[model samples]
Target: MGTFLGHLLPGSFFILYASWHMFSVFTKYFLSQRALATTRDQGGTGSSGGGGSPSTPYYRSTCAHVFPCCPRIPMEGIVKIVLTTIGFLGELITAFEDGVFVHYGNAQHMTMYFAFGLSGVFDIKVSRGPRPALPNLDYVALAMAFAMEALLFGYHLHGRTPLDVQVHMLMLYTIMLCAVATIVEMAYRRSVLPALMRAFFVMLQGTWFVQIGSILYEPLTSPWDENSHSQMMLATVLFCWHCMGIFLLMAFVGWLLNSRVKRMLGTSSVYCQLERRLEKGSATCQEALQLTEE
Candidate 1:
C-alpha cells in the first residue's frame, strides 16, 4: 500500500500536467492570434497574418486552410490543442481502467465516459491540423509526450498491477526524444549553439529510455512479496525511469514558459495591439482568439 501511495502522487501530477498542457495550448493560440491581429492592425512589413485565426468556422469567408510542405504549418497551434484533449481522454480511460479514480467509489464507468467526452476536444482540434509534428515535429511530439506522461503519472498512482506501471513508463520513454528535440529547437530559437549539439544526444537518450524501459518492464511486477529485495530493486529502477521521463517533459515545458510561446486553439487574436486595424483583417479574423483566462 505504501508503494501504491508513491505511484499515486505521480499520477496526480500527470493529471494536472495534462490539464495545464491543454490550457497552455489555448493560451498560446489566443496570445499568438492576438499578437498576429495586433501585428496586422499595425500591418508590419513582414507580418503575413498567417492563414488567419483558428476560431473561424468552415468556409467562413476565407481563413487559413490546410496546406502541404509545412504540412498544415498554418494550423499547427489549434491542432495541437485538439490532440491535447485526446491525450487527456486517453489518460482518463487509463486511470479508470487502472483504478486511479472512483469518482465517488462506484462511479468509474460514469467517470470514464465523462473523461472520454471531455477528451474529445483534442480530436476536434487535431482534425483541423495536418498530422502531428512537421514544422519542428520534435516540439509537437514533445507536447504530445508531455500529455501522455501526465496521464500515465495520474493513473500510475493506484495501479496495483505491473501492467499499469510498465505501460505508462514505456510511453514516457517515447516522449524523451520529443522532449530533447523540443529543447534543441528552443536552444536554436534562443541562439545557443551548444544546446543544439546536446539536443542530438538527448534525442538518442530519449529513444534508449523507451527501449530499455520496455525491456525491463517485461518481467517486473508491482506487488512483489513484501520482503523480496529484488522487487525493491526493480521498483527503484522504475522510479528512476519515471523520474527521467519527468525531467525530459519538464524541460520542454520550462522552455515554452521561459520563451513565452503562444498556447491556445483557434480561440481569438482580437486583442493584439497592432492587429486590430487591417482593412481586410477583421473580415478574415475568427472568434477563436478570445482568451478565456477566467
Candidate 2:
C-alpha cells in the first residue's frame, strides 16, 4: 500500500537515527569508564583522561573527534536536519500522489510536516556549536512528532480493514511509549534507561512498519483476510511474536556489550585495586560482626 510505504520511509529514518543514538550513548559510557579506570591507576581523580579534558558526561558527539579541524561544528545535528528534511519531503510526495492533500487527509500530512520541520530546526540549533548540551527543544520536538503520528493514524482508521487497523493500533501504542519515555528523560535527567527504551522502541517500530508493508503488499504471503477471524487472530499473534523477537535481539546485544566492557575493566590495574579494596572492606566487616557476637 502507498500509505504503508509512506510510513516505512520515515520509520526507516527514525530507525537509523535511533540505532546511531544507542551506539553513541553506550560507546561513550564504556569509553568514559575505561578512561576513569586508567586515571585511577595513574593516581588522578579529577575526571580528565582519554586524551581529552573533562567534559560533560551527557554526550560527546563523534563529529567532535572525527572532524578535529572544525570541532565546534555539530555534524550530527546537520545529519539530523538532512534526514528529517528527507522524511518530511517523502510524506508530502506521498500525500500528493494519494490525493490526500486535495481530500480529507490533508490535515494529517500538514501535521507531520510541521512535526518534522520543527524537529529539524531543533537539530540545527543544537548542531550550531561543539559540545552541545541536550536541550528542552529537542524533547519538545519529539513530543510533537509522536503526538502527530498518533493523530494521523487515528484519523485514517475509519475505512481500514481489521488487519490494517490492528497494525496501526500497535504503532500508536509504540508512539505513546516513546512519548512517555521522553517525558521520563526530561524529568529525570541522569537516567539512561528511559532513553535506551525509547531508542529500542523506535527500532522495533521500524521493524513493524516493514512487516505491515509485507502483510499488505506482498502477494506471496499476505495474511490479511477481513472475513476470517482466525486470520486476524494469527496476525495479532505474529505482532506479539515480532515484539518478543526484537526484545530478545536487543538483550543479546546488550549482554555481549556488557561482557566486552567487563573484559576491558578486568585488564585494568585500577579495577583490580578497587576490587581488592572492596574485598578488604567486606572482610573487616565480617570480623567486626564476629567480635560483637562473641
Q: RMSDs, each prediction?
A: 14.6, 11.0
Over 4 Å off in model 2, which ranges? 1-4, 40-72, 93-107, 129-135, 258-294
Best by TM-score: 2
Residue pairs with backbone atoms closer than 3 Å in model 2 (clashes):
none
Kindly list the per-residue Cα lDDT of model 1 for residues 167-202, writing each as its tens digit: 445445544443454455444443223233233333
Assess each prediction's global lDDT (C-alpha) against the native. Answer: 0.38, 0.58
What TM-scores do the predictions have? 0.28, 0.71
Give model 1's clash tally: 35
| 1-294: candidate 2 lDDT, tens digit per residue | 255675567667767767665654454445445645554565664443576433222222221111223334555556656765665565566556454465446446556656766765665564453334655666677677777777787777898888778877887888778777766766664455666777778777777777777777664564567657787787678778877986787677666765666566343342332222220112232231122112
Q: Which stretches of candidate 1 lie over 4 Å from their true place?
A: 1-115, 118-227, 253-294
